[model samples]
Target: MDLREKERKTVEILRALKKVNYPGYSRDIVSFGFLKKIEVYDDDRVFIDLEISTQKEEVIEQIKEKVQEEIGKIGWIKGLELSVREREIFRRQKIPIKGKTVAIYSTKGGVGKSSIATQLAYTFSVLGLKSSLLDLDVYGPSIPKMTGTQDSEPTSYDGQHIIPVEKEGVRIMSLGYMAKGDTPVIWRGPLVIKAFRTLIFSTHWPDTDVLVIDLPPGSGDIQLSLAQEVNIDGIVMVTTPQDIALEDVRRGISMYRKLEVPILGIVENMSWFTCDSCGKKHFIFGKGGGELLSKVYNMELLGQIPFDYELLELADRGKIYVLEKKNSEVAQAFLSIAKKIIDLLKISV
Candidate 1:
C-alpha cells in the first residue's frame, strides 16, 4: 500500500470499529471515545489502539473480540492487532450503608426474583433486624410497585445524597419510584453504572443489618459492574424449577464465584402446585431442579416456594405477601430462606 493509500486505509480501519460496540452496551466503542489510534501497515496489516474506562477483564476481551470480528471481514487485510488500555473510571467508594449486602440474582428473567427479594427484606424486618432493600435493577425496578411506594420519590436533603423511601419497616430505594408507570430505562452501560453510583454510593441508607439488592436477571454489564464496585457479601441464586432456569442459574453461580462473592444458596420459586380435591403436590415447572443444582454444585438449596397465585395478587396490590399470609406455605418458605440467608450472611439481629 502507498503512503496516501495507507492513510486512507487507516481511516477505513478506524471507521470500521464504529460497528464494534462495548461489551454490553448499544453504543459503539468509537463513540465511547475508546479508539485512540489506528495504523495501516505496508503489508496490508493493521494495528488499533483503544483506551476504555472499564476495568473488567472479560469486558476487555469482549471489546477486542468484537473489534477483531468487525475488522477481519476486509479481504485486503492480512493481519489485525488490537490493544485496549483500561482507564480508571472512578475511585472506589463505600455504599454509605452499614449492612451485609445480599443480592437476589438470576441468569434468566421472570422467575419472581423481585418478589422474593422484597419478601426476604420484610422477613428480616419481622425477625427484628433493621433491613434495607435497594432495588438496583435500573431497567425494570419492580420494588416500588411491589412495596406500593411507586408514587413516592426519595428525598435528597443534599443535591448529591438521596434519602431512601421506607415501606413496611424496610428502607427502600429504586429508580422506579421516580419514573412513571412501566417506563423503560433506555440507558447505556456507563449510564447504568452512573445510576448505581447515585443510588448506591450517593444515597443515604439508614443503619441496617441486611441490604437486599434485587438485581436484574442476567450476568451482564450491570451485574459485573455492581460486583466490582460494591462489596457484595453474598448472593442468593433464584430460579424456577426448570432445566432452562437451572442452566441460567448455573452460569450465574460461576460468575459470582469468579467475582469471589459468597453463594448463600438457591431458592426455587413456583416449585409445585397443590391439587384442590386430591391435595397432592404436583411439580409444575419440574421436580427437584433446585435440589439437583444444589447437589451438582454442592451448594445448599435454601427453600422451594410453591406456586402461590395469592402471592401474585399480593404483589399486584403492593402488599407484602409474607406479612399478609404469614401462615401460608409460600410465606413460610420465604421466611425459611431468609433465615438461611441471615445465618449465611452472619447478620445478628
Candidate 2:
C-alpha cells in the first residue's frame, strides 16, 4: 500500500479502537487495556503490543483479542506481542449483581420487546459481561423460538441447584425449554408465579453481570408479580411509533414507577421501514409516538430501529445481528443502546 493509503488505514484502526467501551474491573479482577508499543515493519506488516495485568489469563486474553481486532483493520498486519503481569485485584464482598436483574416489558405485545431483550442480553455477553435471559412470558415464551435452542433442561450443579442453558454466550432459562415444544404452558396465576420463582432463585446463574427478564405484556398479574418478587434494577419499555402502543407504554412506565423500579430508557422499534426497491424511508406505523412518549415520561429515547428484513431473517435463525454483522448500521445501533444501558446501571465488569 502507498503512504497515503497506509496513513488512512492507521487512522481507521485508531478510530475503531476508540469505539470499544468495556468495564475495567470485576469483584476481584482489575482489568484494563494499556498500549505498550507499535512497530510498522513494512508496508503491510505491523507489530502491536499490549500490557495486560490481571490474575486471570482469560482476562489478559480478552484484552489481547480486542487489540488484535483493532489492529487487523489495517489488513496484512502480522505478529502480536501480549505481555501479561499478574497482580492483586482487590476482592470485595457484595451482593452478586454480577447477576443484576433487568426486566423488559411493554403495555402491548408485538412491540419487539422480546427482540430487544434478547439482543441486550446477547450484547452483554459479547462485551465480556456474562448475562442471561429469563423468558418469564409464561403465556407466550418466544425467546426459545427466536434463539432456536430448545428442550435443553437446566442441569443441577449440586443436585439441588439448577444451571441455566447457555447459548452463544448468554445463559437462558425458558418455559419453552421445559415443556414439550408443541404443548402450550396452560397454568393458573399461582402456578405461573411458582415457575417464575424457580427460574430465578433455583437456577445457578453463573457469576453473570446481568439477567434480562422478558416479561409478558400489559398490566397483567404476572407482570406485577414479577416486579414485586425480584429486585429489578430497572425496566426497559418497548413500543412502536403509534399512539395505540404508546398509550400502553405510558401505563407500563407508570406500573414500574409504582413498583419502585426505575425506567432505564425507551426503545422505539419498527419506528420506520425502508423500501428496498425505491430506497425510500416510510413511516409505516405513523411516526412521533416514541418522541412524544419520551417527552411525556421524561426518559431518554434510547434508539429508533428501522424495520429491516435482514434483521428478522437473522433473528429467526437464532443469529444475533450485532455478532453476525458488527459493523452494520443495525449492529452499531444495538451496541450504542447497550452502552447506554450499562451507563444507566453504573455497572462495571
Best by lDDT: 1
True-structure RMSD for candidate 2: 18.5
lDDT of 1 by residue, 1-349 (tens): 4567877887788778998888778999889887766756556767677878876989998888888887887779998766776874534455667878898988888988999999999989999989999998898888898998888889987787888898879999898877666667867778888887778876687587888899888987788887778788888888788886444665676566645568888888999998778989998788777887776566889999999888899899999888989998887888888888888778887
Candidate 2 C-alpha lDDT tens digits along 1-349: 4456666755665555554433364422122344443334333455344444546777667655666666566555565433333443423223234557778878887888888888888888777888888888887788887887765677875876777788888888887877756766778878887887777777777587888889888888778877666578878878788875444565576566645578887888888887878988899988987787776566889888888777799888877776787776666677788888888887796
Per-model TM-score on C-alpha atoms: 0.73, 0.69
| Structure candidate 1, residue pairs in collision | none
Worst 10 residues of 2 by lDDT: 87-96
Residue 126 of model 2 has an lDDT of 77
Per candidate, the number of residue pairs that clash is 0, 3
CA lDDT of every candidate: 0.82, 0.71
Residue 122 in candidate 2 has what lDDT? 84
Worst lDDT run of 10 residues, candidate 1, spans: 87-96
